[model samples]
Target: MFATRRADLVLILVALIWGSSYLSAKTATAALPVLAVLFARYAISALACGALIGLRRRPRRWTRDEVRSGSVLGITQAVVLAVETYGVAHTSAANAGLIISLTIVLTPLLDRREGRRLPPAFFVAAGLCVLAVGLLTSSTGLHAPRLGDALMLAAAVIRAGHVALVGRLTVGRPVNPLHLTTVQTVVGTALFLPLATPHLPELAHSSATTWYQLVYLALFCSVFAFLAQTWAVQGTSASRASLLLGTEPIWAVAIGISLGGERLTVWTTLGAALMIAGTYWGQAVERAHRTSTPMEESLRSCRTARADGAARRPGAVVASSPARSSSRSRGDTT
Candidate 1:
């Protein structure tokens, strides 16, 4: 139980890092181009991850399999961040944060598509999330979603796909998380390098404040958060990890309203509440499913034992009756 609680705290810290990142990202992108901010973030993160790898006595190699797997995963991650960065730039950091919570709803659907069955409550939770998103996007009016909101929604879906891919790729493989993270960050940097080249020169001339924001994003949000989450998730259920990280949108809303100078409305509040509730409900269902698996297996074993015992009962009686009659006949002759 202590281990579970500790993992929960670690995961929540991951959420906090991500939650605070919306503001940081908003600030960085306000001054620099989206690609430039992303490039700087990943470049710093890659360096940090590499340094971490070096601290190990025998760092894992980047094997062919690792390269292939990491490249796919990294590119997917790059796309997720790119969309998110651009989306946050156009939208309020609060909106970006809350809307991205759609990832929690989308992930299980992806898992279901890959042959994992979910409970009915999961559908109910998903419906609530869908309703929440709809309410959030339409709060301005009963019109089309803003460009930023749409991009964020797209990012959420992509993020879900990224999560699903990780599960699939790592299922039976001995993939080193740190090595994979390093490769992913490096690849992410490479993906954004060209797009950010135009602003690279400006990076040197930028204010210390801008550089500080970049460093914070790289070190805390990307490097530390990623590593901590990876380690924590390995020690807990995926549902538990999702539940803890799902608080990100709440933090986003809180930070945005308090610090980012965003306004709150009734609809926004309602939507936020619904989104959080749905996320928690879905996670609960998943946890229940996980916890019940062993009981289900045990029940199956018990039924099998009962069936076998019943099948042998008549045979045992017949076999015993014949032996008893033989013993009686022998006693009479004696």
Candidate 2:
């Protein structure tokens, strides 16, 4: 029970870190290109994850299988984040947030593609209707979803697909979360390095202030944020964690409006309202599906149980994992 609450708290902090990041990204990208900012975050994220594994849990040895599995998860995660971060650099914070929030609606659609029938209320039709209204009403202007916006939309679909992937990657797999995280970060950073083109000359020529901004993003948003979230999700409900994070744009908007001196016009406000409504609505649908599912019917029934092990009698996730396992889109967020 205590662990569950702790995890929940961690997830909330993650939401705050991620929520505040929109402004940070806004600032960092002013001097850096979209790719450079993405590079720094992934590099720092990998470093932070590695440090956590080393400092906290002293494993006698890491198995090769573990390394491989972590790599798979990390790559997938890195791909999604890289695309989303870059996209955010191109679009308005409000639009990014509201669009990313549509991921909640995308989850059910992804399920359908996988051949599973989500409840009618998980309604692909309805979620899309709400989402279109949100997008159409955005004050940011309904310009034919720019390349950036299109990139972000892809990121959202990829992100939603990952929820299932996380479940798939983590199932029956008791790999240390830190270890798993490190591998992912490292692999992701490596994958992006080629495209990122980290120019030391460019950095050295940049002002000290820019470096400071980079550090804040690397440390607070990427490193500390990931540590807080991974720990938190282990204990809290993923759905709850996701919901909080999904609302990050609101935080972004508020931070920008209050501190950055941005305006919250009517179009943005209405669009944000619609977006938030759709996300919460999607969450409600997921929760209801969990409640109604029978344990014997499907293994995913375990999501409804408390994280600390007091799962409702049956252990749905107690399957066999390959130390061993084998292994998405992009999106931007508000």
Candidate 3:
């Protein structure tokens, strides 16, 4: 239990690291094509990680099911990065940052349709409204990423599906998050490489700054951030995991304001605030729903059954009062 809390904290911190990638990616794309930049980022991270694994020589073996599951997970992440990279290249850094963060809202809807507990619908509606505001604030001067925005929206759906699938598939199973994450990086890179081929010549002229950006995305964002995210999600709730991740745009906004010299007008600020507020409320509702799950009700039910058994024991009769026991089981959702 104590360990889980610490892991959750690490997960939130990892989100911060991955969130800061916006600035790094935005800067790298100035001289590199989007696909090439992401290809370099994942390729570097995979090579480094593979070397570390080789050094440890850990015999990390998996069953066929694990490979299949991990591959599916990888494909989802790959699609998301591809779409998000394209979106970032075409849109303002702020808009890409905020729009990707909107995955928090999309995740629950996926979960609900898959038989996971659903949170309040208001939050979902509000999130779409906030996304519209983001579009408005970020679009202008023939610079609007109509295509890029569509791609980012696709990324959002892909990410949400990944979260939902992880939650449903890994329940009561022994799935290594690190292995799964590494596989996804491999898959994402595999998809990007073909697209990146045309830009290979550009790499020869790239400077040290580009390498630095690649290293950050590769090591911090790709490997460690993924390992941390996977570990945290197993112990934490999806909305809560995503809620902690909800801090991402905040980090992006900070990076933009400080390094990019970007300023937020009143509308952008208010829209972002509205988006954050809605997600928080959604998380609160989701937590309430989880705690009130049938599992908890079954716990109370088992307690009643135990007492009934005790009454049948020699001279051991519990009182027949029903009020207190009823109260114990009467959760809001129950």
Each prediction's RMSD over C-alphas, in Å, is 8.2, 13.1, 6.3
Which scores better on lDDT, 2 or 3? 3
**Global lDDT of each candidate:** 0.85, 0.67, 0.72
**12-84 in candidate 2: lDDT tens per residue?**
6677667677667777777877677677777877777666667855554676656878877777777777777
lDDT of 1 at 71: 89
**Between the candidate structures 1 and 3, which one is better when assessed by TM-score?**
1
Task: Please provide, for model 3 over 49-156, each residue's C-alpha lDDT reduced to its tens digit, 9 standing for 90 to 100.
Answer: 667567765657765656677778777777777778877776556656666765666776778743655745646755554555454355332234466566666777
TM per candidate comes to 0.85, 0.76, 0.78
Q: Cα RMSD for candidate 3?
A: 6.3
Better of 2 and 3 by TM-score: 3
Task: Say which candidate scores most in lDDT.
Answer: 1
Best-matching candidate per TM-score: 1
Q: Where is model 2 more than 4 Å wrong at Cα?
A: 1-9, 111-116, 124-142, 234-243, 295-334
Give me candidate 2's TM-score against the actual structure: 0.76
Clashes of each: 0, 13, 0
Residue by residue across 90-184, what tens digits does model 1's lDDT show?
88888889889888778877865335478888889988988887777766555678898899989999999999898887777878887888889
The candidate 2 region of ten consecutive residues with least summed lDDT is: 325-334
